[model samples]
Target: IDLETYIYWSGDIGRQFAEALAERARAAVKVHVLIDWIGSRKVDSRDLAMMREAGVEVEKYNPLVWFNLARLNHRDHRKLLIVDGEIGFIGGAGLADIWQGNADAPNHWRDTQFRLEGPAVGQMQAAFMDNWTKTTGRVLDNEDYFPELRPAGDHYAQVFFSSPRDGTETVRLMYLLAIAAAQKNIRLSASYFVPGALTTEELVDASKRGVNVEIIVPGAKTDVPIARYASRSKWGPLLKAGIKIYEYEPTMYHCKVMIVDDVWVTVGSANFDNRSFRLNDEANLNVYSAEFAAEQARAFEEDKTSAKLISYKEWKNRGLCTKLLERILAPFRSQL
Candidate 1:
């Protein structure tokens, strides 16, 4: 198990998850957990002590060390749960109270997680082990974690990951390549949508070439208003080029998904922003099956019903105060 945020709250969803892991550990399941140090700041040390006493091996990724200050900004934002080399789960949801419930209340955030049981599970395990070895300096290379898997379905899928150590721009390059190859339509759902100049240009060009492009982003219920401001600053060209953008209205929208041509789909931790593409370690599952893509596209359309579209005229004639905020935060777009 690897997560960015693993908050521990008493008598809630967080408690339920913590106790489950502890129970498994007490049963001699050989559980190993990895969580980000900064992201888990809300975690109680008592819970960690309980799990440790139960025989769970837990480690924090990139703890504050004087010599490691250079890489402090780069975090392990990947969310992965691989069980016995057979089942794997990946997505943007973290183990916290905010991610609980069915998005029925404002406190319950909207998110998505995908479960897998196929040949691609091996790759997902490897993605987890990549950081595990780096953090613990011990390789978990055995049949318990790398058992042979058979084809569970007919979908052609690939689980890929990117980190600052391997390359800074691999996730960005993957998104650009998929966007450039789109010939029919693009349905993008981004929690944070701060696209740089080149990505903005590509979307505008795709719109010009008659590809139906639409994006969904967080509106007033965002966790990072500065990111939303920076994202809006770059949307003038896209809106002018006839690309439709929508803002979700209910609660915090924390889904990261992109579907192109109704046949190719990518979903996971990486958002459509510089922080995810260049600064943090991210993972995504790309599925090349029309059947699966069609299901996801239908879900995207369902989500659109809860969103309100932003017109170019409205964006152009916005209030001066809002425009001022965008300009003030424009220089820090990369950091957002």
Candidate 2:
């Protein structure tokens, strides 16, 4: 309500934010919609058509079968919206279509997205443009996409982007770095958790060091039954190593969050699984700044408090056949 700039997302909490956003977009400057084709699953052919008709500039990253997208595996998993190019929103949250709620239902979802205001918003615009160029094959040098991207509010922030094509193992490295930086604690919440060896080792090592380590993966998932069981395969080793594990039974958790020592916080589209680290195009934001870290840390704790904590005893009680299936599926993390 103060500045001409605003950033909004539309999944769950983001839905309320999106309606307000639509009004602002139509009456004010300009609205740029950037979303992942895979993440926005409920967003179908009709939805895209309506968005385009609404005068809101819309673009889908790595469009699955669109003739424009020759490579189907590569998708724009980054969910960001830039209002007037000076403020932006980026995180695990996609526009509300399928993701609606949290922990209790495991069938719903648990996730969060942030609205950022600072010089960093410019970098988000740049990330959007990079994807836009790749998807549309159009040069975005014109002022229409990026007006005078200026700071509308005070906050220290940075925008980070990565993909199979971007040429940097940034998403994985950032997670490793945050884990390495943890001194007192590490908390991770994800809907999916088939972590890479590095991530797996870090979580194990952190717990061994007497650092409090906790992880949450969906007990119920929005995907395949085999994949859900596959995710549970590695939990035994992790729990045996002293890492506390929890499965949200009420709904499928899609939250991608990690808080390390209350000094570092990460939020975005990347999961701890190998598919995110090695296969899919992903995005994550690391905030070293104290304020954002605190907010993120608080959110992590709140979610943790409301979640179901898994016990080693219960995990060990599962049938031997179930355990075997997970390990067999574990090797395919890179392909998932």
Candidate 3:
């Protein structure tokens, strides 16, 4: 299991999950856990000791150091879970208390996660091992971790594992290509939505070409208010191009999903922001399945019912304070 954040181990959900993993370790399961060092800074030392005592191999990615300042910003933001190399899970939810309940209450995040069982599981496991080896300096190659996989579903899927070390924005390029090829409709659900200039222009152009483009983002309740401000700062062009934007009203919306033309569905931890594209190690599952896309589209529609639409006129008439705040934060858009 690869978790971006694994803090609050004493909480109800966290404790139960930790206990389950420890039990599995005790049962002779080959358990390996990798967590981001900065994201899980608050994770109790005792928790790590417990897991290690149970024979679970645990490692932290990129521990903080003054000499490695240049690499501090790059984080392993991917969330993955693979069991016996037959099943895999990936998405935006982290192993923390904030992801426990529904999004109706404060601090309870709205997130999305998907399970896969098939050849794709191998890809997900390989992605995990790529980071696990880098962190622990131990290569994992065994039938227990890379078992023979068979077709488990009819859906066609491809895993896009991206990192800053690749010297290219692979995930961002994928989004741009998908947006360019969209014919009818494009629906996106992003948490941090400070998109770059090229992506913004592409989205605007897509909206101009008679495509029904809609985006669901977090509202004033977002945890990163600065990121939300930065995101809203550039909504003018998209709004003018007839793109409809909705803000989830209940809580922090942490889902990163995109559905194009009701056929292509992409979901995972890749947010529509520069940090995700250029700094963090992200993974997304691009699926070509009308059935899955329909399900995701239905969920988007339901989320819209709880969202508040932003009109062009209303956005244009924003107060001076808000505009000034946006200007003050514009330069930091890339880091958001």
lDDT of 2 by residue, 48-157 (tens): 45444555566565655657465666666676667666567777765553455544454456778788876677677777777777766876665655566565544455
Clashing pairs in 1: none
Please give the clash total of every predicted structure, in order. Answer: 0, 12, 0
> For residues 136-161, could you state the per-residue lDDT of candidate 1 as single tens digits?
99999999999999999999998999
Model 3 C-alpha lDDT per residue in residues 1-336, reported as the tens digit of each score: 433332334466666667788899999888888888777776777777888899888888888889988788889899888888888888888877888877868879999999889998888888888788878889888898888988898999977688888687888999999999999999999999987889999999998889999999999889899999899989999999999999999999999999999999999989999998899888888899999999999999999999999999999999999999999998888898
TM value for model 1:
0.97
Off by over 4 Å in 2: 1-44, 54-57, 63-70, 100-107, 142-155, 221-224
Candidate 1: C-alpha RMSD to true structure equals: 1.5
Q: Is candidate 1 or candidate 2 better by TM-score?
A: 1
What lDDT score belongs to each candidate, Candidate 1 first?
A: 0.87, 0.67, 0.87
